[model samples]
Target chain A: MSDMHIDDFKHEALDHIHHHLKTYVSVFVALMALTVVTVLASYLKLSLTATIILALIIASIKGTLVACYFMHLISEKKTIYLVLILSVLFIAGLPLLTLLAKYDVPVN
Target chain B: MDIPYTVQPRPDTGLYNAKVGIWLFLASEVMLFGALFSTYILLRVGAIDWPEGVDVLNVPLGTLNTLVLITSSITMVMAWAGCVMKDFKRFRFFMGLTILLACVFLVVKSFEYGSKFSHHIYPKEGAFYAIYFTMTGLHAFHVICGIVVNAYLWGPGAKLWKKNPAQFTNRVEVAGLFWHFVDLVWIFLFPVLYLL
Candidate 1:
């Protein structure tokens, strides 16, 4: 409430921004590097499974960087985490269910 | 009535109201795109002869757009950070840059789409093009939406900063969240549609 305390809070806020800015730049460089890696890997002519897995792994890492750094999910609230967790559960379930239905045939 | 928790974290949730709202919205978005992704997987698995994306789609353009979007994501984050630092000019610069990058992405995408159309490759061409058009089109729509929101924040919505800096910062943060989610979608889409 005092003016001294207000100045202290301002310094703290500025420090946080400085730290976040560094992270933003670092994540950006990493993302660009990974983009190049993904593109190059595609031309390697790996088998279908290897190709899919490798591409996905790179994409997931890139996605995580965006989510954690750019989206600020790394410091987000527990409520937000819960919402995402539930959504991810269903997102994961959707494909598994689809695959199951596709392969599940009535035995003659 | 003034909205509570616009600038301050709520007691129970420990986040500003918009922060909670945006994440919930993003969660649903994840499901929406996830369903389409599942459909893609289903169709690809069932098809006897799936077309190679690299053979059909323009990888160079896709790669270019990928870099554009990634750059926008960083700028978007920097814009929010600018607000956090109480630097209005910095915020406007980065926010405008983000919008411009989004525009570049759309321009590139339009060229890509135009080439496909000229080649008579519509969504009806086959399952591959169908999913390709559907996913990238949806992602592009999201990009447009982000541009509109960011333009407002940079142009008019930013007035809120003078009135309530904390709330304005929160708005940018929320917008950045959505923008990054769009970028995240493209990170996956680029490889899945253009490369793999």
Candidate 2:
């Protein structure tokens, strides 16, 4: 058997840490750009449907930026990602599901 | 020679402890405010003629408060940087400025709320006012809580500042996270309550 040790694990962890720090600056710039886009989109007089859709799309981009960078979800363990995914599902699903009930009701 | 007491370093999680804890707390807060926002949207959609007279909300003042809160966020971050650099004087200075800014935010918010109260624009009457008061009231409560926490962390009686500097930074960072959340909520509230 070879005398391999846990030092390799430590070295790999350090490499990943270095990569994360390097990427963080780019992530911050992207988030800032997304914020600018959202603000600009707000100024357009799109119809209600188009406006809401565009706003939601921009919001999603911003949310992803915050989750991945500020929250460090990208570097986090898989279990944490699972928990976050579950949270998004619940937060997003409940509102849509409730709105669906409104569709089934007859309008006067 | 006098014997020096060696301070124990906090366990390193590779990230700052206070920053991590504050972010976790903010996650829950997002859910709390998220529920309020959903309620507002539902009520607004169901309203027959949405609340009129909302134009009474002072846009200029609200805009001022937004600038104040955003500036405070910058100060808070600077304070955190001071901690990383171990610059106690700058840390205290920025932290004090953040608290003052928070108080300014509260005062402006109070004026806006007071205007509503004087006009009998309450949440009890109809859907618009209901969502309006509920959302704004809850946010105001958060602002008050933030102010109190800021005072505790930066006030003269703060033990964390004297005993353990790292712990103090952690506390300030946590408070800053909450402060930023308060600002984030207002970003959404401004357009919904004042502009739209």
Which numbered prediction scores highest in DockQ against the true structure? 1
- TM-score of every candidate: 0.95, 0.70
Candidate 1 regions with alpha-carbon error over 4 angstroms: A1-12
DockQ score, prediction 2: 0.10
Per-residue C-alpha lDDT of model 1 across residues B24-55, encoded as one tens digit per residue: 99999999999999999889988998988899
Per-candidate clash tally: 0, 0
Model 1: clashing residue pairs?
none
lDDT: worst 10-residue window of model 2 chain A: A1-10
Give me the displacement of residue B73 in model 2, in angstroms: 0.9
RMSD of 1: 2.2
> What's model 2's TM-score?
0.70
Local accuracy by lDDT, each model? 0.90, 0.64
iRMS value of model 1? 2.9
Estimate the lDDT of model 2: 0.64
